[model samples]
Structures are given as structure tokens and as C-alpha cells.
Target: MVDTNRITGAAKDIGGKIQGAVGDLTGSKHDSVEGRLREAGGQAENLYGQAKDTVRHAADEAYHYAEDFYEQGGHSLRRGTREVSRQVAEYPLASLVVAGLVGFGLGLLVNASRD
Candidate 1:
């Protein structure tokens, strides 16, 4: 979450540049190799950061979609309940029986799906 790779990459890049400069000044092969390795590490870290950013964006989009679906479902339930209640007012007994049967069937289906 903190994007440590990105931070490390930046640090490595700067460190490599400094080390490479020093190696050049002192004519040291070992220092040159170390510097190149550091630079490679930094580039890898930068790539990782980009990948993390892409994943974060995708997760955010998925969360928004789920939230939208939940909100819409709640609204649909409320509207359906209101309409059903209005219909029930016109015929109490038949509506009650039908509603009970529908609820039982729905419950059974839900339970079956969970299994």
C-alpha cells in the first residue's frame, strides 16, 4: 500500500548515479558493476510501481461497481415492497398467502445456491 518498491527504486537510481560518478573518478571496476546493478534495481522498482498503480486503479473501479450494484438493489427492493403493499391493500388474504409461498420458495432457492 505504501509503494515501497517505488520509493526504493528512486533511492537506488540516485545512489547508482552517485556511485557511478565516484567509480569513474576513481577508475574502479568493482564500483562500476555495483553502480550498474543499483541502476537495474531502480528500473525494476519503477516498473513495479507502475504495476501497483494499475492494480490499485482496477480495485477502485471494482469497488465502485459493487457499491453501485448494492445501492441499486436496495432501491429496487424498496420500490417493489411499496408496490406490493399497495396491491395487498386490495386483497389481503390472497396476497398474504402468495407472498408467504414466494418467500418460502425464494428462501429455499437461496439456501440451495449457498450449498
Candidate 2:
């Protein structure tokens, strides 16, 4: 996942350094200043590339985490449904009573909210 910008930026930075060195040895102020500017630009590009890589990595991790969560939630919901079905089948009368009570409680809550 290494970015091309990082590679090119590093190469450019190295070239700038060499240029600056040569300019200094030859006593050319213009070349030296220009080399410094190029070096700065290269460093900036490298930093930008690094930032992009960090963001991409985070996005990938988040996607995988969400996918795993969805799968686990689906499995748990299916398991819960099976358990509830078994319990209701085993105690039909009790299940009916409980369902009625829940409905009544919900109705009461709704009526109270309206008031």
C-alpha cells in the first residue's frame, strides 16, 4: 500500500539535496536557493502522501469492523429467534399470557403518552 507520491517525493528530495550541495560548492546562490525550495516542495508532497495512506488504512479497518459486526448480529438474532420459538412451543399457555400482558402494558404506555 505504499503510495507512488511517497516514492517520487523521496527521489525528488534526494535530488534537491544533491543539487544544493553542488550549488554550494560552485558558489551559485541562485541554484542553492532553488534547490532549497525544491526540497521543501518534495517534503510537503511526501507528507501529503503519508496523510492519504493513513486515511485509507483507517477506512479499510472501519469497513472490516462494520462487516464483522453485521455478520455477528445476524447470527445472534437467528439464534435468539430459534430459542424463543422453542420456549413458546413448550409453554403455549404461559407464552400467550405473557404476550397479552406485554400488549396491555404497551397499550397503557401509548394511552398515557397521548394524554
Candidate 3:
């Protein structure tokens, strides 16, 4: 989306240029200086709008990237869960032994932490 500031600034810059040109032709130093100052201000405003646009675009890209990463991670986790379930179903005894060992190891870790 184009920033409103950019459009207004461009219009202001054009008006300033016209004013300055007219001032020069009519020999009005005050008008010339004021016009030039206005032009400079317009240019600054335009730059600010451009900066805002750049930052917004960058943020949008980052958000999309994170969303994609999260979706991919979820799929991987589901696949891993299915694979583990299949393995356990195919070897119930081995799975049971492994689960008991894991529980025992966790108990030791918890005791160590308490100490």
C-alpha cells in the first residue's frame, strides 16, 4: 500500500517548485527562500514515508516466513508421532521396557535436582 504521506509530499514538492520558480521570475527573495524550505520539508516527508513502507514490507515477509516455519514444524511433529506409535505397536514389549527406563531416568534426574 502506498503511504498517504508519499502522495502529499510529492504534491507539496511540486507546489514548492512552482512557487520558487515564480518567485525567481518576480524577484521575491522571501518567496524563493520559503518555497525552497517547503521543498526540502516535502522531500524529508517523502523519505519518511518510504522508510515506513520498507519496514512494513520487511515485517510482513518475516511474519509469513514464521508462519511457514510453524506449519512445517507441526507437520514434522505429527509425522514423528505417527512413526513412534507404529514402532511401539509393532514391538509392545520393547516399547514397555524403554518407557520404564525413561521413567526411571526421569526419577533420578528429579531426585538430583532436589538434592
Best by lDDT: 3
C-alpha lDDT of candidate 1 relative to the true structure: 0.90
Q: Each prediction's Cα lDDT score?
A: 0.90, 0.91, 0.91
Badly placed stretches (over 4 Å) of model 3 are none
Relative to the true structure, candidate 2 reaches a TM of 0.92
Two-way lDDT contest, 1 vs 3, winner: 3
Q: lDDT by residue for model 3 over 1-115, one digit each (tens)?
A: 9898888888888878888888899999988888898888888888988999999999999999999999999999999999999999999999999999999999999999999
The TM-score obtained by model 3 is 0.94
Report clash pairs, candidate 3. Answer: none
- In model 1, the runs with Cα more than 4 Å from the true position are 91-115
**Clashing residue pairs for model 2:** none
lDDT of candidate 2 over 1-115, digit per residue (tens): 9887888888778878888888899999988888887888888888988998999999999999999999999999999999999999999999999999999999999999999
Ranking by lDDT: 3, 2, 1
TM-score of each: 0.68, 0.92, 0.94
Candidate of highest TM-score: 3
lDDT of 1 by residue, 1-89 (tens): 54778888989988988898788789997898899889888989978987897899899999999999999999999999999889899
Query: Worst lDDT window (10 residues) for model 2?
Result: 7-16
Model 1 alpha-carbon miss at residue 70, Å: 0.6
